[model samples]
Target chain A: MAAGSGRAVVGRQGAPLWLRKLGSMFLNVYAMAGFLYLLLPVFVIVLFSFNEPGITRDGVFRPAVRGVRNYRWGRFSIDAWKDPFKLPDLTNAFQTSLKIAALTTVIAVAIGTLMAIALVKYDFRGKGPISTFLILPLTMPEVVMGLSLLVLFVSWGIPRGFLTILIAHVMFSVSYVATTVKARLRGFEWRLEEAAADLGASPQRTFFKVTLPLITPGIFAAALLTFALSLDDFVITYLNRGPQVTTFPVQIWLTKKSGVPVQINVFATLVLIVSVSIALLGLYVQRRRERPVAD
Target chain B: MSNARSTKRWAPWALLGPGVVWLVVFFAFPLVRLLTTALDDSETTRRLGGGGIKNFTTIPKNYGEVLVRTFTYSLIATLLCIAIGYPMAYFIAMRGGRFKNALLALVVLPFFTTYLIRTIAWRVIVDQEGPLVGFLRWTGMIGDSEGLLGRPISVVFALVYNFLPFMVLPIYVSLEKIDKRLLEAGRDLFASAPRTFRKVTMRLSLPGVFAGSLLTFIPASGDFVNADLLGTDSTLMIGNIIEKNFLKEQFRPGISALSFVLMLLILGGVLLYAKLLGTEDLI
Candidate 1:
């Protein structure tokens, strides 16, 4: 049991064995509790997704009272799941979020993947400055990014709407995509392309056959991440979304003044399920690809 | 050979062109333009043009309390993250056994949910009719009218919760990198377990703590949602102020200045902390 942590020494150092056991036991319990703390809110969110608002007063259901939020169990029902698009603002905003996230993923991944491949595949002038530039956006606060972009759009006389939001999402997402793809590119074998060339394959053929397949997983992972980032974005999108546009998070913020809607949780739960599924699918594909290599 | 060499010369630029241009135009240029906007006068007469530096000059005095509170909450949240996250990270890295990947995935699970949705959940948990409020009422901590949702502690708790994974992941990476053989070497040298942890494990993980602290603090300081949803007017953060002012056209210059000042302070603080820690590689 002490093999991993090297706490095996405490027993040898005149400390009683039981004391060491108790310490390790305590450490494990603390970690378990920490995980619980981290996950509890998410659990609550899922649980309340099925909550039918307004306790069954006699036979009819009603929305919870005005001052207090509907937080009780309130009888488990799939009303939210059945009517996920019950709120117009939320549905429209969610669709817009998905659209922007999709467009942003495509553009950002294309641009960033090329950059990452170039950076890894070849050394060139201005590499250091370019890398540093990429880091700046990642480190900058979303508030700053949002405000700055808003300023830029207003000054440029560009209307703030779906286009502006797309630009903002793509702008912020590029560096993350770059960083992820770059990290993935680092572990790739450059020799394979060379080997293909030596075997009389043309450069394009070498790329398609040797490099593309090996790099797809990284690019796919980066795309998934970019999509997630774009979808979950609130601060940046809110600032740049303007009067006409709204994303899911922005909708949630706007609706906060009114009341909590069950549809928000239902959609949120759906998103969670989709993202987790995609992640698992990615993992499965990567594992399956590696299995052949292992054999 | 000449043709291939030319392709080499142009290949990197060709690939880097779109991303670089996009960042410069959309990211870098906006920030520069934001600075000018910050320096612009409060009057809408010349809203598009640059003006005097009074926005910067008056921000400190006007927003002093908010500036201080933002840093204080972020600092406290960062400290709490290290307290909670470090042990969890250490345990998982050292003792997670075969369940390591699964546990790590679980840690990242909440991130799949939208940020506002997760925050909304916290609102439910601490609202007037929630379990936490019931518990606190039972404990005689407060009356039924006094809910848990809008308080300093709730704000800080949400901050810690939101950023705890950021603290944990980096620390876990650092802890995982601690060579097991070295710990064995410490044992062979007759160092006790606690001493070994203090000297080797703790010292080696400073970089992780450094990283985790920055991750937790930077976002926590700039965070708007946790404070906005969980706390009332008295606990409103600089981010909430930034959000409000930016939305209101009359306050753009002042808010721009505030945003610029906040960015400057964060950069300065990070540099100073990194310098004090001698983590020169952080840059």
Candidate 2:
């Protein structure tokens, strides 16, 4: 037993083994706890989606009294899931968010792709300054960005509405898309394009057939990220949106004062599911692509 | 030859045109306008033109407490994030072995959910009768009647929770880059485990530390949602003030002035941090 204990106490590097063992044990516990902290809120949000809207007293949904609270388990019900769109304004806000995200993704991806290509493929005056200037918006606080844009819109006589919100979303998203695409273009081989040109391809054909295909994955990734950013945005959208326009986040902010509806959780769960699916799909595609090269 | 040369010269411009123009018109122009708006007199209602610099004087009287509180809360939150995040990052980078990518993905997965929804969950978790409050009360950390929500501690806790991943990922990136041989070298030289960590590991991870702090600090400082949901009237940050001034109160000039000053302070902090860290590629 003594010999066995000694053998177990020795580490690979022959250092004092108790310290390593203790340190690693502590670290593993800390990491697991941290991950739990990160995931606990998400789990709670999903779990509460199944909760009955509230205790119904004689055909009336009675909310938990303000100061008096209950930690008891809520009865399970699928009513929220069954009628996810029961709240008309919530649905409208969700639709508005989707519209803004889609439009922002399209416009930002187009402009950002061009800018990325310019920065990577060509050298010109103001290239350095322009590259640095693009990062400025990212470093600025979201509140500052939103406030300044509001001031600009008011001064320019542009009515603050869907158009203004769209512009703000695109403005913030373009830098992100550009940065993503530029990082992808870095270390990319120019020889492929050169070879295509040498093989009797026109400039447009070379770009379409060679360069575009090579960068499609990066472009797709950037678009997905930009869409997520736009969808999740609150600060900028809230500040700039007109009374006529309301996105999902703004709706949540407004509704929080008057007891958040259960359908909101249902909507949030759906979004979480969609985003996770996209991420998993991206991972699957990446693995499939990498497998070919590895083999 | 001249035609080819000219085409090459103009190609970059053509490609860069739309995006650069958009940024200039929307981003750059707004910043300039904000400065002018802040400095312009508030009494001149329709003056889209210009006004005197007296509008700047109102900032100290109106927003001094909020400005101070904002930085203090942000600073405390940043410190807490570093404390919690660094250990997790170190563990993953050093001991994750085959599970490294999976662990990193787990860190990022939580953020894909809606930010406000996650914050709202905190409200539920820290409710008056919630398990967390019960645990704290049982542990003698708070009075029996006291709850966790609607307090400064809750606001800061939410901030740390929301931005912890930002701190972790950067630190993990830097920690992962530290060669395994360096740690082995330290051990070979008879340095103890703690010494090895302090000198070799900690020294090298400063860049990540700097990056993580900046990422956490900047966003937390600007955030209003956590404070709004988890805090009471007296616990408002600069973001809450700016939001109130911009939206409800419709104090445009005051909002602009407060925003300009906040941006300048953040800018100064970032520059000073960059200088201290000796890094220029932060963006």
Candidate 3:
């Protein structure tokens, strides 16, 4: 309980130095176990993505071993990765997911960034109600959000499909986008814009020159988060995606019902790779930007 | 002056307009519509020919077991997240040194994968013929007939696994923000290290725990995917019921009612929790 970085307690402690170090080691072990538990599934998913599933005569790539699910490790093969989009349904679903996620990111980030800026900078009428209203979606259970939206489309007689999925994705994700951007916007110096304006910059020029660049990091971060959420969204997407529309997650669920496809693992690993790569790239860019300022 | 005043009046709305409109049409109105859907009672009357609020009332009587089970399972998951997440968050915040951001990223990396797939990975881990269960069976720890799949503990564990990052991040943020100088001051004031930690460190991190608990609990309680994919019908949750009801036409009222009950219960619980924790700022 008392362990920390400082040597003050270390020098005064009755316990031996090794024993004190052992206490910290316990925390380290506990943390490693926690991380192991956290990453166990990711490791499984990635490992199984590489597993060569037994192709049955009917063309389904489940485990060849009878009476068991396709999760067991099979002979090592990269067949799934080599032909990642083997299933027509999987390809179609992946395309649809990518499209919705992209569109959702663009729309949510734009709307959320603007809203966040307004809330942070301006004393708008009904700001309280608006803030609470935006926070509502974040608090609402996703199932409720999906069900209600599903019902809304039904009651409104709007066809549930690609557009509905887009709407649903944008709806749930906008708040998250707003919150992320808002957190970033909170500490921003509004005086920068005023200073630009004072230097004879027009409102439009001042915003473009001063404000936009300052908030771009926040906006970028929000967009990345939104893209991930939109891409991986299943429950709401399931509710909104009519029979004709299928996203990656909905396809995975459908596949789960039929059989666990090795290709499913393949595509999922792709998603993990793509997202992690983007995150790393973003981190690298941020680090590079800060280094110059630090120097 | 009038032009400037008008621009000021219209500017914020211009910024807020599209997002607020989208939220109103999609987010806010649907919830209001959900309430009406829950209480509409048209379907209930058509079938049974009598029952006003039975849509809400009958749920407790009919599926009370499922409802209770769902709450308890998620509650246990939330508690587990705190137990597991706190130490992990503490380690990263206090001891991670230069590796904190990387550690946080690792914590969140699992989330980038499809939520369903993550649960499926657990499904693999706990399969009847899978290594873990096979080992357990071999050791006679569990009966040959007994399986890990479809168990309540499995579902709870899935929730914990899925939501652990949420709990950890907030706690990490809070812990990282704590000043080391405070601990030093406690040491100087003749407080023992353990006493300093209890009186200073943990006290400051209460808000994080409060936030993390809500973050873990709300979604876990409402989540159906973990229960659906991991557990059998014997361990169904309210989310499964809501999902089922959403599918069939006759179960419309039940769908909304069950969802409403879930929202209400969660809201009430959060309020009670906030009160107990005395974190008035959150509410």
Candidate 4:
């Protein structure tokens, strides 16, 4: 205690001398600056969205001091939010995105879960090679993957549409989900399953009743992550989506081909908020469930 | 075989069936077909092979220029991510309190947002009428409309901004996993703080750095989203060329060969990175 307090005294006495503690603090400050850099453009976009002047003349967005009139309130109105179908483009895009995301998430999670189970529960030939093959898609560039899928579809005379989009999403997203579930399975004990079987449960019942509940968190994480990946996928969707099938990202990309509107800023903020909120909520729920183990 | 052996034999296959089917159909099939076409399409080979290695060569041609530009842009963006992200990762991992998870969550949240929307948003912020331009002009930094977004720097800046979290999160996880006692031990030996960091912290965190850079570089190198919205036609990356081939040009054979070559290059780099980081288990 004396030594601790004495060092505290020494530290206090040397407060004016940062030479003793220069590098660490500098690194900390440098890191914070980097954080600011990372966040600056995003925040600026959100900020500038409110700067709309309701009209553009001579290629200049006349600055309006963020009055309610300056907000594209009626154009991108709350009515559209409440009844999305009123705006056919947004509604169609939203519905398409939801359908694709939901299907992709379900397929990815189910397939990934089964693979994780087999990987953990059995020893098989070519296991190492198989695992590598499974993980390859996750790291592949989205554009390359998108182009390759497009080529195969064209070659095989498969028409590009909703089915193609969903298939492509599931193809890429399954790898991520599989890796997540497999990591969860790695440290899981087999005794619980044995105990269930010992108590007269069949293998399927044992898995459903005991093992499934334990691994559900990982499965849930996988689903949510896949949903985001599916919704956000542009490269693949851009390549394979039929002319009539425009998801939100495709719409935004097309709009970018024209001049950008400030409303895009508003929409982007909402997207960022929604995605961040869902991820955080999912993480919060998972962490709450995990607290007991951590303790 | 007996019934017991049959049941046991099919169980693992039953479990693995869906995943294997999914990969074989969507991944392996597509790659096989694309590569076969790239090497076999009569017209493509006739054109490309006549030029020998020169056709596949990554120079002189506009495609070659685009590839080089892609490498240069991604390399710059990746370096910037490391320079800007490592410190941020260190800050959140070492000194942040209960808010660390919340902050990290913020960093990753952008990943969930649509890439198209994010890139488009940057366009609005940097447009001629955008506030960024106004602020710069007001500060007398530029007198003309051709300011931030009109230049390569802004394109690189936007790429760094979008991809920075990829660089930070992996490093943050690695840093968080490091033993605190090791750092304390370094300090106990009366080494200066910088010395301790260089010898202990940086050495241990190298894996995370490699992982983060791999995550950033691979995506950024192939990314066309930022280049499209933030860059001019001259600044397009390899992804833009791929996008053009698929969409506008419809040069399937050239695009396939380009894609195949690009994949090999990226795979080689990732393998090297994994080796450097001493992690052979990378997917």
Misplaced by over 4 Å in model 2 are A1-16, A53-73, A293-295, B42-52, B248-250, B280-283
Docking outcome class, model 1: medium
Residue B61 of model 2, lDDT score: 76
Tens-digit lDDT track of model 4 for A1-295: 2332344345533333455457557877786677666566566556645543455457755544443222221222332233324445655776788889999999989998988888887777767887888878867888888888888888888989999998999899888988899988898987988889889999889878999998988898788888988888888899999998988778767755443445555556677788777776877787886787753
- Docking level of model 2: medium
Clashing pairs in 2: none
Stretch of 10 with least lDDT, candidate 1 chain A = A1-10
* Better structure of 2 and 3 per TM-score: 3
Considering summed lDDT, which 10 consecutive residues are worst modelled in model 2 chain B? B45-54
Q: For candidate 3 chain A, which ten residues in a row score worst on lDDT?
A: A1-10
Model 1: residue A19 alpha-carbon error in angstroms: 2.9
Candidate 4 wrongly placed segments (more than 4 Å) = A1-16, A20-25, A44-86, A259-270, A283-295, B1-10, B43-62, B138-145, B248-250, B275-283
Candidate 3 collision pairs: none
Q: State every prediction's TM-score relative to the real structure.
A: 0.94, 0.92, 0.94, 0.87
Put down candidate 3 lDDT per residue, A1-295, tens digits, no spaces.
Answer: 3444455445663456677578779989999999999999999999998776554456555557542245667557888889877789889999999999999999999998889988998887799988888887877779989998988998899988999999999999889998899999998999988799889999999988888988888888898889989999988998888899999999888878767788888888888998899989999998887886653
In angstroms and one decimal each, the interface RMSD of every candidate reads 1.5, 2.9, 1.5, 3.7
Ranking by lDDT: 1, 3, 2, 4
